[model samples]
Target: MGRTFIAQRGQTKSTNDRQFRRDRQTPEVRYSIENAVEIFIHAKEAEGLRKSTIKGYHDTVRYFRDWLSHDIGYIDEITSTLIRNYINYLKNDRLPYQGDEQREKTKKGLSVFTINIRLRNLKAIFRFLVDEGIINKNPTGNIPLVKDDEHEEVQGLADAEIDMILGSYDDKQFAQWRDKTLVLLLLDTGLRINEAMSLTVDNVGFQQNTLIVPSEIAKNRKHREIPISREISKRLRQLVDETEQYFGEGSRIFMNAYGDDFTADAFRKRLNRLKKKLDIPKLHPHMLRHTFARNYILNGGDVFTLQKILDHADIQTTRKYIQMDSEHLRQQHNKFSPVRRLFNRKGKRL
Candidate 1:
């Protein structure tokens, strides 16, 4: 073969080209906090986090970036002491975003709960950076969540309140009927407002008497079937049928007058109008969910079952519903007090 040269096993034209490129390429410059946040957001999106969750991450970081005079030098420049100073700023100096007129008018500084949420979001970002080897030290490692001193028992709507709210909606009107069904659905299922709103006709299972909260809409991103009562099933069926008939065969169960999806903001505005008309100031969507959880516990439903129904990741979160049902606990204690039962038995023997 006239002295044929053999190619090395590990060497190829492509490999040599890659090696040359690697040698000539400049090392990656340290990322600024702004750059890191953008990368972090993309990472979260790739991980399939909800838009709302990703927006929260962006908002929290944006506040920090603004606090640093919009020039967060580099990711590594973020330190525990700097984070503590930001916490102090959140506690004392940071005002509610001017975008929310209600919050701006009502609040001066961030609530402990709000501050803690921002801290947790920041911690998540830094933790992600550490895991990706973007930063060696996490600035939020030593930071503790702001302690909420005013933790109060969860308050759910009473029977009278729920009845009044339900009665306010006229079944004759499509919008009214839809809102009433939504309220009933929230109360019956303990579904988050967004989850309930995102539901479509396909999510309803009249034959099975269940509502399927798809993994995409669910906060925990777990697919779960919530059993529905006959009343709710009927209402859902009617809502679905009417929505299709009126809105021209859209998949969304709830629709605006223009046949578009009923957005959360629109629902809130409707609730605000209802609040004025019905004189129920606390009439909000989440309150219905709270009502469901508390009533479920009070009506002798187990915490374990309630946890699944509410899609709570932690049993501790479900236990709070039990703790909030203090009146129910007291009634049970009164009915089954061991000391009282013992005394009664002794008297009978005597």
Candidate 2:
């Protein structure tokens, strides 16, 4: 069959639009750093980037301006030297809350990892400016990211601690069911709290035994499905039944008493109350995720599979679970090494 030329209008329109853009692409005026920051952020927002990401750009720009004492000029003035000084300043900046109410006591400065984050933000901004012809050189191209080892080891709940927390919930009542389901879902699926909380009744496919994470709620903006156990499916169905009865079929699975969708603040508040009631120190949403990852690693789940389960963009992020597993290996080696049998305490030549 020959090509059915249904409508060449879209192609013709796009060609004309590209030609117009090229004709009007000459931006000869140099934008002030402050003005360019807003332009770049607005551009990002226009491109449908996440609000959290755009907010980060705003925060970094505001911080960078404050660091400059509001004397920053045109975008062209941004140099490798200025960025280096900003990095040094970030290295030396301390927080008042790392201590007590004395206000005079300040703890050590931000960690290398945090400093690297700010530097990365700067890199993104300057790179954007360079692309737009608002700046001549990429001021951040030469600055190196901070080493990961500069931060403390990633922490997670132990297996016994997981048991303690899970056991703490009675699950006899509705509230208990909701709380336990929240915790366990995070553990089982490694779903971010926001992603889990965003679930509507329809998102939980009970028949298929899968929890569908829509792109809008997903961090990576890619839709994915999580396989659910029969028990989870049953609990989800029960929760859906109760929630729909209260707030109709359009109800969120994790709504508050007021029928409002659960927010991170609400989760934290509930977790804090639970912590105080149970007297457990370290219980939070992300720890449940870490626990999930650790458990997955120890139970012979590989990094690639865990990465897909966690919806991570890069496998390097998933590789941290290997380190957690290695820690367990070190403990096991110390406990049951057969080589220990040949060693004597008073070893001259046993």
Candidate number with greatest TM-score: 1
* Whole-model Cα lDDT of every candidate shown, in order: 0.82, 0.78
Residues forming the 10-long window of minimal summed lDDT in candidate 1: 11-20
Model 1 misplacement above 4 A:
1-28, 70-72, 99-103, 323-350
Clashing pairs in model 2?
A: none
List ranges where model 2 is wrong by over 4 Å. Answer: 1-28, 96-105, 148-152, 170-176, 272-281, 322-327, 330-350
